[model samples]
Target: CGIFRLVVPCGAGKTISALRYALQTAERYEKRRIFYIAPYNSILEQNADEIARYIGDDSAVLRHHSNIVFKQDDGEKETKYKLLTENWLQSPVIATSAVQFLDTLFASKTSAVRRMQALGNAIIIVDEIQALPIKVLKLFNAAMNFLSSFCNTSILLCSATQPLLDELNDYRICPPRDIIQDVDRYNEAFRRVEIVDCIRGNGFSSDEAADFIFGLAQKVKSMLAIVNTKATARRIAERILKLSCGDSEYKVFHLSTNMCPAHRSTVIREMRRYLSDEKSSKKIICVSTTLIEAGVDLSFEHVVRSLTGLDSIVQSAGRCNRNRETICGTLSLIYINDEKIGKLDHIKEAQEITREILYHIHMNADRYPGGALSKAAMDEFYSKYYRSLKREMAFPLKDDPEHTIIDLLTNSPVGSERKQTAGGILLKQAFREAGEAFEVIDNTGKHSVIVEYNDDARKHIHILLSSHFIYEQKKQLRYLQQYTVQLPTYTIEKIGAGIVQENEIGVMILSNEFYDKVYGIDDELKI
Candidate 1:
């Protein structure tokens, strides 16, 4: 009837359990529809597949995300799919990214607002709820309040380490009911991996870290290292490959946003094959960015995670010993001294705070009886993290330092009562300004570049270039999303027109020379 939260450990099957609850509630209350939202495209893809299998009808679930592209079909099928995607109402169950869901609730664009009515009398399930950006705390809480209070919608938020949303001073949501009576019991029961802190005075250099990770992989036979940035990930992966030059049995893989969706999926599939096959003799080592930290289904014998937020560490640890098959799996947290995080203010701040928390945990272990991954530790982490980010939680506008997105959407100084004339209220709420200012991800200077990674990608690009009609090319562009990567415009420019250039249809396409078969876009390609 209102907003309810479910707190469960990573491996407790929260996905299917949440689905069961949503279905039951929908059937009982005769809800209009059910929407399952996640924070990233990776999580959306996994959940969409699982929900399709559970419902026993793939067509009943509508996937709405950046990577989703419906195949070319007959006119009837195309029209039906297009209509469902446009308004997001006809589908019985919709699996979409949080970007889409949040925009539908907050964005002022007609295309986005058109779907807002569909959310009424619906049950919304949000997975990995803590992945929300700190800047949108107040706005997100306000949106949830509107949907639950006035729209007759039920919202279920599921997270391993939930944030304290109620602690916000303004636009707070109703106090949510906890579905799980004792979350600490489940946390203890699902405890599979232990955290090994490897952070020292100035941390280890990339070469030293790579050497240590390589040695550990040789012993463990399977390991995953998640770094903070793409440059660090590629550097560590290349160094590991150089160290294991003559080792024929070892397979090294790299994953980051620089790789297209299809390429990343292919790498993940191969990693899973080697990890799951008991008879296979291949020793697998994967170096990836934080993209693989949440809602990814890969399990490793050992994991190395770059020091960041405690919540992120918990999510990374979920990838190790996930099935509880290993007797003792370890997730070593290390700090790369040479890694440059100057532009990554959030991660840097979180790292400093996490270091402090780890120091306290080591010095006073008795206070945190449930260890680092316990509820007690998570509570302290969020409390400190939120306090540090209190100023940004209001989503202050950069260009207009005097007001915030909340103020623009609700009350603006321009639309005061004194300005009204003849009993007519002036349009004071700045919808266009707010919409232009809001960004789920900072896309200020980013541009999407379609890469010719495989035969399918090339086929799409060829069609996109050769198509005579603009409508056909639009469809081809959608199909190419599975093979596209977003890079900073400055980086693209520095890479030079020799490697990246616009096609006949004005789409940015990266040549094959700069992309690697295993490591994705070459970090050294930039001039």
Candidate 2:
């Protein structure tokens, strides 16, 4: 009775609908709280704040994620307690990123399970479910089954382009019934955007993409170009600014993780202001990373998206004509073949398969069901993608007989008393092994720095170095959440003699010369 699916398209009011459903589900089913798990902290914070507004009680909502530390407040110690003790099992309505959600289920640490008791009989809504890494699909699926069947919790899988999870042989997840109502009718009713594939014969180099995007920028009142890498976004945005020389009518901006959350939020607000009123004359062109593709609700007249995955392309399309602001918005899908795309192996593989589907659709339009954004096309794309990466999906451990942690967890060798067998074999989830294996963001050697971008940031930094110790530092950490950036491990290593102060646990302070007001962390230094 707990496992359900929300199969709505992107930009179709999924968040608000989830909020309303959460309220009703809580009231009717006697569920104590609703837990929302988003793919990114930015998305989780954005939605949690919005839901707080709708519920008319900000304090009722508690945010839990890796990026957040407790701020000044004695009454709201539950959140702080979780922070201090690492037990995150309370709150009436909890908002967390997928990383935190998985840690609760898979991590072997004592702190990870302290809150597991609270998960029973709760309402769990997972947004962007399709974004789950292919390698951990089997593990995540099994965890969901445990939560729903054994824990007495209700689960809802939500996404615009929901994957065919039930179709996967290794990890089959079948919902009781899809909440999509009418799949075809719902899809037909919300057709506010058309996807156009312009990947071309050899894909675009950075120069070619920037030139093409600049040309596209001139025609629309508001446009968004989403790239895969921050380096590409910076390079392309800088090139556009250079080419603009004297064009003052158009407002151009660059957005990525390089910018703090607050800075990105400010940029989003400005973009929405320009898009809301047609009478405004100036155009807005934003060059951004894939961060804007999820939960962010601003729309544009056109979206220029670089191909990565079918799920990503759909999310990008959601940002254009999101509320039916226009008759129809256009999605210009292009493929880049250069180093500009970064070294994400999964994305590169998905890129190839997406192109194969698009090429086939281009060759024969009649046979394909719903054009590029149709169900038939996405189904074929993911099916091939999963098949291509089947071996990786099991998440095999190299030294541990190439068997997945999921295999070990389900088939345990350790008996009831937490003791090993006579043959000296130890196997049971390999909690430590699984924890070490998880790399959602892979910030291994990266260091987190509090960027002094404004007065608010500076005030926090002062408290950070003060005698208040970890408590004061943690309070500042909360304040600096939106004003934080992760520099590469190598960049921190090259802080040089007396250049800057650093720590072994991934904390570094930026000197005046290394920080920039515009780009947050200075990208001028070559890593």
Candidate 3:
């Protein structure tokens, strides 16, 4: 394998360089298609926009993710539609999420099966490769191997803190060099950051954190605090607003996935405008989720990060002092023990390994002899991390009886005997399975009904009722109007009681007593 790594720090033009490599490879091999996979939809959209700008054609690039608005020219009018119904491989340049890409490898859906044929004889760039799901690492590695060896594809594993993918016992894919030859060069180029390791027990509390942020806003030009969860971010923002003086004129912003992409983009644009305008002294403070960890190239003078995995900590550090100016900026890593660090077992184990290494290095200064964390320290960190979790690194679902059950439900071959025999039962079983509950808001401002499922059926009913049907349905007889549902204002008061279930149609909500009390709806209603 002639695969190689391109290790560049934040704001080092890695995305553009990767795209350049892909384009060169395509021209050299005369490849027709190129696949660029990212960890998030915003990133996918961002990269697609940049690629399209460089490539000089929007038609050459295709953005396939949730929230993508596609316009179809059917001659009746330019209709805004969705890309989910479109063929994924039809475009020469495809931008998608890692989940969508990997799901295609394991499942046999129309999108999954159809994209497989286009994967061959193409150049695939896996951006932020370290963010690859731990449970799917083995499956991903196997898939990469099969694609590189059998399928005519070239992969560029791009990231700052690159994981030890080849060291795993079941590893299959291998790259030529550690893509990043000189880590110090990147450090020198981006010399804007001065990492401040805040001592534990002295760190800011919820209220203190708010005060500190407000003080910083008054002093510094711009700032950002990247926390762990949405709820924490919201709490911090609320505290800041409460403590602020009258007419203080501070522009505070809260950003998280809880808001839609359109909303998030609007916030990001406002932040950028504030940063770029020198005349406007409107102090800006943004409290965000881990979504800003990678690919988002927003530069700030100071950043406060709650203690997380080492890779995440490093990425957060990258955002601060990003410009590498003469004045080295400070980044405070506050030790947050309250955060519930679940999911991604590999990252949790990596954090422990990093802590132990840091402790040992700090205790025996003469042995390591480095005042600051060195590149060798990071290398050793990842090496130890891979060695410790190699056995459990592969897909956790493999050989699990439940996966077989899920496969039967989701990927039973079309018209197969088992699928036909158990499909309906499996579909019903899926509905019975509980899912994450959501407050399904409709347009009429009325608490009409609640359903156990939030799938296509529920969506259709919500849309229809919100549309012109509400007035017509109201005119109908009271008994016939029972089926017409609407979302109410009080429904917003309910926080966490509905269990979202999945059916063949889509995601459904399992209504509970709490929902009944919140919406004041009859429990005997069919919903």
Candidate 4:
């Protein structure tokens, strides 16, 4: 029945330290279960592998993500994994995505709430806690408070750039006990990258940005550029490819959500091989979206990140010289003049706030003794960023603007007229309505399309279509998750039914003509 926070810098062994603490604390308190949750599947997979290696048995840890596929060759092992995922009851340690774990508390679906009982007296570790949506912060805080204070569960929040959750003016978490003493001192000591701000005058165009990145990659021999959109990443990658046409040593790679998970994984493995080969003079340049920023174990000599929130900048920097291969890697922050963040209001606001912070740092350089990546700098950035987003933190309902998700969950007058109480007050909660309004990721018009990227993907799709049993079909769908890419409904509609076949399970199977082996999903179809 404790709420705690672990605020250590990235690349400083935070994952292992948190795992060791959770295991010991769970053993001491006799906790029923241990849950390791992260914002991205990549993080969960990496940490789960590490945990399995540490414990000496892989089966001891249960993976509960949409993309996980147990060895289908071993029917017993596959059945064991499926049963464990059904209720999360058998596994002592469960590694899952943040969305799946959060749904247990917030979602109203029967399948989701059935696992809520598993959380009782559990040790829950949420990594990259700041990545949680801004609108859901109040609901998240309230839920965490209830879990720790009433349900006898222990909640551990871990992040390099922790948001000021307890200091919020509205619904907020109780003061969390810090696991590490002198977090700022530890962060300073573990600093591995130097921040270089490149958003001076008019920012670089698409071509200019590619040239800048190519020049740096030539010198460093390994570089990564993380941008805001897939189109921009592709544009930069294509430009870099043309720039290095004559040099067979330079390999330019493009990675984005447009590519399926399996494709991205293959690309990542190839990049790692090139990076680990010390004898080779190969130059590696990867241009990717923000998906690469979350806990991915790929290290580059230098990283170029588009200007966004301070937390994201730091996360991108984590991939640069992660093991401290050099004295200090450089993270160049650039602004792409041609980029358009249409309808991405949150990103736009964060960009503006970051620009202000950069201005402050430029004006008052003497005030920041530890440079831009310092703890003090992060504090200033989040304080202002959170202040700007104070209104949206409550997760307000669109239809009923007066009431919020917290109001609906706690005390909404849903059945007031139908069932009047003695005091004429309706104490009944609108659980269904609240769940309908709550979304971990905004998927308003988003549609998942399963692509036949390789033999493995096509095999899963065949199983998905041919299977008669509901359970087998469900398992096949989960297997297909790695072969799927999400596109907007309008984009799919524009591509027409000729290119996509909508299945009975409400997913589209992309035609081979629209799917590319290298770029993925064909950029020509992009709206």
Residue-wise C-alpha lDDT for candidate 4, range 433-507, written one tens digit per residue: 788777777776788788888888887888878777888877788778898888887778777863546356655
Q: Is candidate 1 or candidate 4 better by lDDT?
A: 1
For residues 275-370, what per-residue lDDT tens digits would candidate 1 score against the true structure? Answer: 889888888899999999888998898999988999999899988988664886899999998888877787888888889888899999988766
lDDT of every model, 2 decimals: 0.85, 0.75, 0.62, 0.84
Residue 27 CA error for candidate 4 (Å)? 2.5
For model 2, what is the error of residue 210's alpha carbon versus the real structure, in angstroms, after optimal superposition? 1.6
Sort the predicted structures by TM-score, highest score first: 1, 4, 2, 3
Which pairs clash in the backbone of model 4? none
Write model 3 residue lDDT over 1-527, tens digit each, in one string. Answer: 24557777667788899999989989999877888899876678888899899999987777766544322234222121134224455678988887678756665455555667777888888898877755556657767888887877788888876776776665646654566677766766655666666646645666667667777767787778888765567667767767665445677778765443444666788887887787986777778878887878677778887766667777787777566422877777675454455554654676577667667667875554322334555667777877776544443233342442233334424324444587554343321111111011113454434342224324444443444544333322122222223434454344334534233322223353322211223222323
Best by TM-score: 1
Candidate No. with top lDDT? 1
Q: Superposing all C-alpha atoms, what RMSD in Å does each candidate have to the true structure?
A: 2.0, 3.4, 9.5, 2.2
RMSD of 1: 2.0
lDDT of candidate model 4 versus the reference: 0.84
Task: Point out the higher-scoring one by TM-score: 3 or 4.
Answer: 4
Report the C-alpha lDDT of model 2 over 167-266, residue by residue, as the tens digit.
7776676455587776656777888999988878888987788888889878878889999988788777878878777588878888988777777778
Q: List runs of model 1 lying over 4 Å from the truth.
A: 73-75, 414-424, 499-504
